[model samples]
Target: MNSIPFDIVGFDLDGTLIDTSGDLAAAVNHAIGTIGRDPFPAADIHPFVGKGARVMLQRALDASGGYDDAMLSALLPILLDHYAQNLAIYSTPYPGAVQALDALAARGVRIALCTNKAERFTIPLMQQIGLHDRFASIVSGDTVGVSKPDPAPIRAMIERAGGGRAIFVGDTINDIAGARNAGIANIAVGFGFLDGPVEQLQADAVIAHFDELVPLLERWPG
Candidate 1:
């Protein structure tokens, strides 16, 4: 059994906190089209969600299956620019997300969002969705020297949250790895951008819905 009663909760933005896949897909397909390649649908690019823009572009191009590195390099900035223009146009928080954040806050849990996305995009999206003030701290890819799956960002969040007990919630293998690397337990949710069952990520616990987090976190041992 995993322990809980965490005083702080760190969340992953793109996949766990918000579903920005629609806008991301729009941008990616725009890049593909600009290069005269076939555009892939949103569903086909789910696995590429959590990482930053550069990595996502690489994954999308890799998925296209015919692009060379030179081709990817040439198309990335265009895709990023397009993505920035459409950020949050249709992007919104996952169902029950705000309620879950509120519940955790009521229980005295500090909330932080630690993402590989650069601050330029991360902050704006949070503001657009009215969740900018919800987080005690926001650590973006540009905030630290290293990103997730390396643990530095998570450590930064923990430090910002005042270093009590904490839990990291996300939907990707990178989040799981980062949480473990930071010495915090993690709960992987299945309702987001993961390409497969969250169990495959080897998280301490797996939640199928946002509402379940209330019970899970409330029951954790301090």
Candidate 2:
């Protein structure tokens, strides 16, 4: 068989690999509800994701009733605890995601995860989803003391995946900019938690489904 174009394929966790919006929204709502604010619909919470739990809560609080450091500090752990306990309750891989991962693995491509989700949460979430063992490397936001849109975590992902020509797949500006900052190509997912139109992301490519991944990767220019 011909070699795959990329030796390593890195992915962002929350939106790119798994749809964690339901549980995440639940957690955010739980935190906001503690302050007597109304719950936000999970769909409305999508735009607040991709950053981190703290940021997600902050955004929700800001939209609902405003927030302060003390309020955030108090609610952050509450949100995280709620999320951890219910990690996979509504989270699942996007349609055909596993098939795409298997296809990449079959081609000798290493798969790694680089997500802004903190390690404490990322680990349990992946474990609950039954995909923890599939990644060659898993770098959380806290793993390297930095988050995406900074390139540090992306670089750490590449190194941990054993170093190779890498391409990143994600669903946010942070993902696209991080890959670009790290000097790698990026593929944006159209079905992810996008804050704007997919075309506005200006990624190297865009795909509407996981089934389209392998073919796009195969045809990607070096």
Candidate 3:
């Protein structure tokens, strides 16, 4: 088999590898409903993700009524519990994601996960989707003292994946900036949750679908 350009390929969890907006929105609504707030549509919740659950809940709360530290503290666990119970009810891999993973593995590439989602949620969610075993390493926000955009977690992801030249694929500013800060190449997905246009993320390249990932990586100059 021909050698691949990258030994390790790391990916962000939400909005990158999987379309988790449905369940995430449900969880947010569940939490906000406790305070008698109306539920937000999944589409509206998409952009609020990628930062982590607390922030997502905060954004939703801020939009609906208002939020305070006490409300956040009381609602976080409830949100988490609701999400954990409904992890895979609406979550699924993005189109061609599994095929892309298989293609990368076929080329002897090691797949890794570097997500801002905390381990408590990330692990269970991946397991629920039957994808936990696919990654050589899973680095969640809580794995390192800090998360994406800090570079430390990305570095930790590389190290835990057994170390080698690596590239990251993600859909948010944190993901792209994290990879850049870690001094690695990054690819942004156009299909992911974004606050603005995919092009504005300024990744090394942008892929509209997972089917394009392997070929793009193979030809990447880095």
**TM-score of the candidate numbered 3?**
0.94
Model 2, position 86: C-alpha lDDT score: 90
Residue-level lDDT of model 3, residues 99-121, one tens digit each, is 99999988989999999887888
lDDT of each: 0.85, 0.91, 0.92
For model 1, the local distance difference test gives: 0.85
The candidate with the higher lDDT, 1 or 3, is: 3
* Per-residue lDDT of model 2, residues 101-158, tens digit only: 9999889899999998888889998888899999999999899998989999999999
At residue 160, candidate 1 shows an lDDT of 81
Residue-level error in angstroms, candidate 1, position 130: 1.0
Q: Please rank every candidate by TM-score, starting with the best.
A: 3, 2, 1
- Write model 1 residue lDDT over 17-102, tens digit each, in one string: 89999899888889988877788877887677666667778888777776787988888889988987788887988888999998
Candidate closest to the true structure, highest TM-score: 3
The reply for model 1, stretches above 4 Å from the true place, is 1-4, 62-65
- With a 3 Å backbone cut-off (N, CA, C), the pairs that clash in candidate 1 are 4-220, 4-221, 5-220
- TM-score of each model, in listed order: 0.92, 0.93, 0.94
Question: For model 1, how big is the CA root-mean-square deviation?
Answer: 2.7
